[model samples]
Target: MSGPGRFISFEGIDGSGKSTQARRLAAHLEGLGHSVVLTREPGGSPGAEDIRALVLEGEPDRWSPETELLLFTAARRDHLERTIRPALEAGQIVICDRFADSTRMYQGLRRAGLRVLVDQLHDLMIGQEPDLTVLIDMDPETGLARALSRNGGEERFESFGNDLQAKMRAGFLDLAAEFPDRFVTIDGARAMDDVTADVTARVTEWLA
Candidate 1:
């Protein structure tokens, strides 16, 4: 249980249950005697949390994809500087609910040519990737329905509807293919306990 810290990230279309899985993984690791830090993007640190409110609330068009990209990047930078890096340096397992991949899909795929911008800013400002990324795959329609039911005031992205969810699902799968070494895809459209067991098993294997 003593070694270099591991950084784990969870990603999926809205309502894919990545957040729940991420939290479960963190607690599971902690119960196994590993130090764990469970955090989230767009709002991990104080400054980044402030930015999260700005980008994740209001109308769907509250900010253009470009502006949203910038906001996300800025928040990520702050999160890295103030939260992630420090936790990693202290040799704690860092489980993040979402990371740059979310930005790549949500903002990058919203419009053509935006993915290039997403990568550029990511390389320039963040330049960091998690050691492991768990992508929870779920049906777009089902995911959208679940998201809408949340009524989580921060439903800005979910407000975009099923079209975006479908696009994001495909994009996330592509990203998994593109980064096979660190990405693991799991079915999120199952019972929560089933999904949690799969995630725990896969992540435990990685840690081993």
Candidate 2:
């Protein structure tokens, strides 16, 4: 990891298949002769990994939104210092799964009555924005259904009202609209291979 380069992030809810897409895209980039660093938020670093376990375990509802935001930020700062920044400095492409936008959706807006707290904490933390953020927008019901099929139990967020999840999905779309250049919205309902193909194509154009 040597010269300065680009940083990319993938954002979505539990069932959106962001991790799969991220990994596929990384491999695609590597095949094209680019050095790539694949990582994730809240646990890419050693300290972040510890926090990640706590943050994701039990239930997202177990912790308050403000507290959740703090935990995520703590992990993010460490992730940037330990993993992301180093790869970027070395001219490698860094692709992260579920970055700050997840916080904005889950902790900030999705959690009832935490919008203000989410905003304040968002500003305080998450200094570095991704050069490209791929938001895999999809229906909450379908997404949750997929998640449940893959994993047995429903977490705190999954048990939330449909309205909240819908709003979160919309929030992702709005974020993309607000940052047209930096955001790419893909059809997350599609098959994994299709989604990965679209992502790789988008990144290819961006690289050129």
Candidate 3:
């Protein structure tokens, strides 16, 4: 607990292979003898899990943009309080699947300028952010097609139109540009092994 923990987050569109890369990076860290905690936003805490279900499983038409943002924020707040904070304090490297960046992308869909809202909420609720964020970039069509092939059913966000998904991808790229130091852009269009190698190398460098 003496050394500060390293916090890393993986983000992208639903089908962009962020989760797959996140797991591989965590496994690599563990293999390197670092204690690692692999977690996800909106489902990391019990309260957040409930919010996650509501956001993803509730009637799609019933969910407004503000409602969606609020639910995701709620889950994030709980996740930080219950899971993220403690792990970091224990000096564990935490790899998270989806974090504030999702709000930057998805909430940007509803709000004209979502950054301010997300920041204010983070200040009021969740405090710390990841030390590094790995954002995988992929074509919306390809990622969604791959996601659909792997999934049995789609969630509200997963069911977004191609236009929305494209916008979300743009938002992610925009975020990476805006915060070059914190965001590491990885080309997810490459083969799985290649993407995994890229992600692991970044994590290894950052942790070093």
Candidate 4:
């Protein structure tokens, strides 16, 4: 835990294959002799995972937008302290499936004025952003279809339906534009190998 390490996060709607790409990238980097830590937000460290269960389970309206944001931020703080920072200090590339960006889109966009709250909370609590964020861009229809096919209980966000997914897609795109230096937007509709190749190239170039 002494050297500079890379931090990367994958983001997209529920079924945009961001998680798949994150795993693939971790493997690819490891194959190249890099130490990689593959993790996810809302749950990465043990404490965060417990919070994830609370946030992801129960009803969609289980918590107010403000309450949900606080929960996510708390989980994120634990994750950063227990998982991300230490791994980065150890010089291992940390590839997270999701991070604060998901909270920004999920909670921020859920209400009209909540985006400010999400940003303020993040700034006050979780100040780290990924060195590189791979955003898998896909149509909401396609993404939702893919997500629903999985048939999992973690459907709270997915249950928000197509319209919200579409907005989330746009929000992600806006975030990419907002942080051009660190964001890599990739088309997720392509074949798996093709998408992987694109993501690999971007990360490779960044690592160079």
Candidate 5:
């Protein structure tokens, strides 16, 4: 919140390649002699990692939308206390794979009118946003195929299938429009290198 270090987060549909891009950005910043902390939501710290397993590895309907929101909020609180805030306070760039924006899309859109609840809980528990939010926008069907092919154990959300992914893509774009100052939308349909180059250029300019 009141730190010299910058916070950056990447958000997208499940297979938009944000995670890979996050890792690359961290490494790039580190190569430039910056101290960096690369982490992810639902699991940035020890306690949060435990919570990640619960929410990410279950069936699509394992938890009600409200229940899932609570779990995610708890994980984010721990992540903030144990990982994110500490790094920022120490003047280290923190690159997070996903943040509150993910929750807004995933759970908030799970049911009609749940977004209000999501925003309320976020304001109450986790009152933070990234300095920069990189949104990798991609086509839902293609993203779904990429997500399913990974065969990651954490496929609870992906198991919901393509329809959800379509909604998520639209929702992410809407968020970018809503929060224009911090959000940068990138076309993820390009080759990975092209996407990476564009992202790196944009972030480097921002840092400068």
Candidate 6:
């Protein structure tokens, strides 16, 4: 139950249950007496939250992919500076619902050459990656259904529909393979408790 400061992130298509799992893991870690900081990207800090409204709201085409990349990068910078870095320095387990990987998949996969821009911006401004990333792998059909059921106002990305979600899922899996040292792909289609247990087990092994 005791370990060094750790930074963890959860990632997946919107309805893949990453956010719920992230919160569950944070609570589980806290139950073990570890200090935990639970947060999310695009809105972890004040500045980032402001930007989040702009980027996540409005029409799907409100911002061009290029402009969206810049906005996300800016929001990430603020979140890192104001929230993540300080918690990590203070020796707390930081559990982020989403991180740069989302930006990479969401923005990068949108168009040709954008992935390169996403990587470049991340390297230049936000030169940090989570110590561990839990990717909740789910079918696009199931995931999209879950996302739409929420009836949330932030449907900008979800509005892209099933085909894009399928591609995004593939992109996340590729990233997990590309960064095996830090990424763990979890089967998200299972029951919530089952998926949570799997995620908990993975983090426990890593911490051990």
User: Candidate 1, which segments miss by more than 4 Å at Cα?
Assistant: 1-3
How does residue 203 of candidate 5 score in lDDT?
95
Predicted structure 1: lDDT: 0.92
lDDT of 3 at 177: 92
Highest lDDT among the candidates is held by which one?
5
Give the Å error, residue 64, model 5: 0.1
User: Higher-TM-score candidate among 1 and 5?
Assistant: 5
Which lDDT tens digits does candidate 3 get at residues 1-208?
Answer: 2137888999998789999898999899899999999998778888998887777774557687777778888888888878888888889988999998888778766667666777788677766778899999999999878776776543677676677789889989988999999999999999999999988887788777
Alpha-carbon local distance difference test for all models: 0.92, 0.82, 0.83, 0.92, 0.94, 0.92
TM-score quality measure for candidate 6: 0.97
> Which pairs clash in model 3?
none
- C-alpha positional error of residue 186 in candidate 3 after TM-score superposition, expressed in Å: 0.7
TM-scores for all predictions: 0.97, 0.90, 0.93, 0.97, 0.98, 0.97
How do the residues 36-55 of candidate 4 rate in per-residue lDDT, one tens digit apiece?
Answer: 99999889999999999999
Which 10 consecutive positions of candidate 6 have the poorest summed lDDT? 1-10
The reply for model 2, stretches above 4 Å from the true place, is 1-3, 111-119, 152-156
> What RMSD does each model have against the real structure?
2.0, 2.5, 1.9, 1.4, 0.7, 2.3
Error of 6 at 148 (Å): 0.7
Worst 10 residues of 1 by lDDT: 1-10
Query: For residues 28-58, what per-residue lDDT tens digits would candidate 1 score against the true structure?
Result: 9989999999999889999999999999999
Task: State the lDDT of candidate 5 residue by residue for 1-208, as single tens digits.
Answer: 7388899999999999999999999988889999999999989999999999999997888999999999999999999999999999999999999999999999989899999999999999999999999999999999999999999799999999898999999999999999999999999999999999999999999999
Please provide, for model 2 over 1-208, each residue's C-alpha lDDT reduced to its tens digit, 9 standing for 90 to 100: 2248889999987678888899999999999999999998768989999987787768546887778888888898899888988888988899999787888888778457776676676667656888899988888888777766766443556766567778788888888988899999999998888898899999899988
Q: Global lDDT for candidate 4?
A: 0.92
TM-score of 2: 0.90
lDDT of 2: 0.82
